[model samples]
Target: MSDGFSSFAKLFSGYYSDKLGKRKEIATFGYVATGIFPAIIAISMSWTVVLIGRIFGWMGRGIRGPPLDAILAKSIQEKGFRKAFGMHRAGDTLGAMVGPALAFVLVIRIGIRDIIWLAMIPGISLQ
Candidate 1:
């Protein structure tokens, strides 16, 4: 993957997501794409396909990040920006804390493929 494309895609996606005022939608789309792309990568045999999927997945993150922050800001209002951001960070860290446990469970019980499929649930529900 090219660093240039990744950076550019993320920069533009963040710009557009902000411009469009669709923060929630962007956040939901990012989640769904993340879930689906990993599955695509797992199923693919070719390196090219896996690379493309990874690139797209990163782009999907670009698509989501600003909008997710934007929504959180809006939800909390301008005066609460600091608190809102703090809450977001806290929630993110909490998720990070659980990730390893979840991965272990997936590897031992359901497998990676199932985990990928399961990931979609949050995205789909968020949407």
Candidate 2:
């Protein structure tokens, strides 16, 4: 499942992002998926459901990475490219740092299944 997700994400996300010119959407989707899927897993009583959610979430992330970088690069000034990329990278890392801890808490309180619904938070903003 992991391998399948990895392969699918790499190819499909890139393709769709390019075709749609929606890298930002991909990135947003990726983040939302991360937020929601783990929450679902934390809430879910079954491992099978968690696995399914993880696969879907991972694919969103995989699709998001390249297009995000590209879009971010395009959106910024050439002279400030380094700084811009740096800030984005930093923010992404920070989000990663916070997400797991938050997930831990959310899972403890609400379980993983319900937590997955939170993924819609960012996704909603995207539209």
Clashes of each: 0, 12
lDDT of 2 by residue, 38-111 (tens): 55565667889778877876776776777887887888889999999889889989989997789789999986
Give one digit per residue, the lDDT tens place, for model 1 in 1-127.
Answer: 5345556666765787788876677777777776567766777789898788777766666667777776676677678888879888998899888976787777888787676667656656755
Relative to the true structure, candidate 2 reaches a TM of: 0.68
Q: Global lDDT of each model?
A: 0.72, 0.74
Residue 126 local lDDT, model 2: 59
| Total backbone collisions, model 1 | 0
- Candidate 1's C-alpha runs over 4 A off are 2-7
Instruction: List the candidate 2 regions with Cα displacement exceeding 4 Å.
Output: 1-4, 19-45, 105-120
Give per-model CA RMSD: 2.6, 3.4
Query: Clashing residue pairs, candidate 1?
Result: none
What lDDT does candidate 2 reach at residue 90?
Answer: 95
